[model samples]
Target: MAVLTGVSHAAEPLALCFAPPHAVAPDVRSQWQQELRLILHHSGYELKLAACTPESIELRVLRSNPRQPQALGAARTSQSRIEPVVEIYLDPLAELIGTRLAGPLGRAMARVTAHELRHVVGQQAHHQGGDFPEGYSAGLLLAAKPAHFRIR
Candidate 1:
């Protein structure tokens, strides 16, 4: 759960939060949380984990005319709204739970979550292209290997 600010020069404030894992299998939940935390730590943002009312997250993206390449192009813009509560569902019951694939998948979700938070904070316009830094990718997160026990 990380929240970034100033994604783009003209984007609205954004917030990225992580919903508690609701995996039926304890091990799976633990793994998922761990991977999420790793990516969040590297995202260079703040984390806020609290209870909310609504059960779903709200994300909005608006496309504007492209700006000049060289000159400080116009700032990008964005808007986001997160419900009070987080929606939770059973984790996928796949045999790859504790394998290399599981780690990468969890890392990918974490990256996406962090990427979204950057939008909320106003770092980038939306979750596309190389707008974000290089390390946001799952391969990088895995290669770096975060030290924390669980994804916060």
Candidate 2:
């Protein structure tokens, strides 16, 4: 597992904790991390692997259930009196093998991760609609390579 902190000076502090899939290759995980950082960076946030800090938003990465229906990823807030945590399931993405999305798994995973992070930072689950919003899809952010990502 790895812990990452966002840009400190930002108005809201954020941290990302990643629990890599046991069966996944190390190189693939590295690629995902790289892409995740780059994608998040474009959103004007910095990420560093470390322990959770005071008042920092917490997010986690875990493997999803394979026995269930197809789900590329899922994220939700874990309500707690102390600190709430956001979790993103990755087993579904990890299970995609020899398929059309296999080639872009890393980028796809990054997109999913970015989507979840937006939820934590925005503190809401609203999508702008019209196909793909800021957190809903990476086609615009990752493909178009915008100067910065706006949390809408």
Candidate 3:
């Protein structure tokens, strides 16, 4: 079943729709998109969110998450289409910047986004560890290179 499931999505591109928060600087947003593109591309995924076309996955960067305050983001299968919808809270991720971890909000957002997308794409029943299920690491998020945020 797992093998079949993996095969089913192997050739499909990750066509997602998401926009950066309005408050972010244009350069920051552009850099974030490029960084995430590098990560996903290196990990064997194609990112099509820039076009913002209607797609199977949608991501939103919300002001805050009252239900799960500490969490950076979450994902759920959309009830209407059974597709994945991802929600990321900007405040919590923004707070991490300049802390002991020390990182930019955009990079942190990308890291969290990558993690949540994996659960939906993999249809993971359990987070076996490493990146998913497990919390994001400041070290990984703070890294200069983008290849470390692997989806699988």
Candidate 4:
């Protein structure tokens, strides 16, 4: 599931939209949004909530497994000639949460979102490693606590 953000110029504000899975609690979604904002802020970016379309980050939810792939979330960089569309899968996160209803899935998911955004916003065509500007290993990003990556 790719959310399309048309060619966003530097002059336009960075905006985003939560696709579906409307069933998710507002507070949970808000919490996730706040987490993402904090992460992006530390990375030197501002986030704005936008409509479902017309140039914005589309947050979409997908089945846990899209053919038993290893990645928990993926971003579409080639979808548009310009800005890429970001998508995060919920199934793997659900698996990690495993029967624990109180697990930090929301927080984890937010981290995944931030990881993808780094690729799109940072204009980084390739990942450095398991960290961000430092490098990014999806596995490490998903498994570690948010505190692990401190703000500079």
Candidate 5:
């Protein structure tokens, strides 16, 4: 699963919408949605609580069988070219449920998603280098816990 890390400019209003598969548990889904909102709020991005359209950023959490748990979050420039569409995916059970390390995993997802959005906004490239001034560091997002969720 990919997490959203940070945005290029916080002042620009951005929308975050979840596109989950129907198989997800209600409780778990709610938790994930709440966590996403909290991450956006604390990170200083605007959360548009509407359904995803061509103009909005879409974040998804799905189950997959990979060697290691991972996330795939990316941002794409929209058709209008005014805002970027950020997409986040995560290993459903691994990152969203309450396991021993779930807190860190969720935080990581948020950070990675943010990173992808930055990429979409032309703040940073997929790869990092001295030339990329807006590189994302996962450590920053994990530094704080979500406002509504606790690790313990």
Candidate 6:
């Protein structure tokens, strides 16, 4: 299913929006959203992000599970098709980034978010290669900086 060249690898601009995270700082949210946008753009998408409508494919930022602070998050899917709702935890994201290299926490969060999103966009399963890797590591999250993530 290789697209080859001069072909699009993404769905035509879908209604992909994000739910504003409660109790999260505005600046952090802004940086996260901006970085997420840039990553998706670089990864070849033209999604129309906005406040969630019932029909929109929404990425909701939620509070982290206190017991699993290091856990990134998950995307809900039905059958083989990804569902409209994708949830990620901000507190855990910050915890994963940790105090080391705290500067890029927001940017790093974008990568983590994009990781989950690719699962939806590419209709991919874990470890199917590309952005849907088997798992994440601190080194990858903190040190690695790919120009753009691959979808497949």
Q: Please, what are the lDDT tens digits per residue for candidate 6 over residues 1-152?
A: 87668866664565677676545566766766677766666767655767778877777777775666666767777886777677777676766667524347667776777787777766765656444576677677766654445333
lDDT of 4 by residue, 1-152 (tens): 99878855353356888777644556656767777776766555677877777677787767554665556666676644325567777666656555213235566667878877766666566665445543345456546766444322
- Steric collisions counted per model: 22, 2, 0, 7, 21, 0
Instruction: Please provide TM-scores, in order, for all candidate models, with all chains considered together.
Output: 0.37, 0.60, 0.73, 0.68, 0.49, 0.74
lDDT of 6: 0.67
How far out, in Å, is residue 71 in model 5? Answer: 5.4
User: Ranking under lDDT, best-scoring first?
Assistant: 3, 6, 4, 2, 5, 1
Q: Can you give the lDDT of residue 36 in candidate 2?
A: 68
When summed lDDT is taken over every stretch of 10 residues in candidate 3, the lowest stretch is 2-11
lDDT of 1 by residue, 31-82 (tens): 5556545555544433433343243233211121234222111222424442
Clashing pairs in 2: 3-50, 4-48
lDDT of each: 0.36, 0.53, 0.68, 0.62, 0.51, 0.67
Off by over 4 Å in 6: 1-14, 66-69, 100-103, 129-131, 146-148
CA RMSD for every model?
12.7, 8.1, 6.1, 9.1, 9.3, 4.2
Q: Write the per-residue lDDT of candidate 5 for residues 25-96, one digit (tens) a residue.
A: 555445545666665665565656578777776665545435434434545455455244554545533444
Ranking of all candidate structures by their TM-score, best first: 6, 3, 4, 2, 5, 1
Candidate 3 residues lying further than 4 Å off, grouped into runs, are: 1-12, 19-24, 50-54, 78-82, 99-103
Clashes of 2: 2
Give Cα distance to truth, residue 148, candidate 6, Å.
Answer: 4.4
Candidate 3, residues 1-152, lDDT tens digits: the string is 34444443343467877655544556556666776677788678888765465555777878678988878878865543324777877777776554412236666777787878777777764567645546665566676467666677
Locate the minimum summed-lDDT window of 10 residues in model 2: 94-103
> Any runs in candidate 5 off by more than 4 Å, and if so which?
1-11, 20-44, 64-72, 76-87, 92-102, 129-152
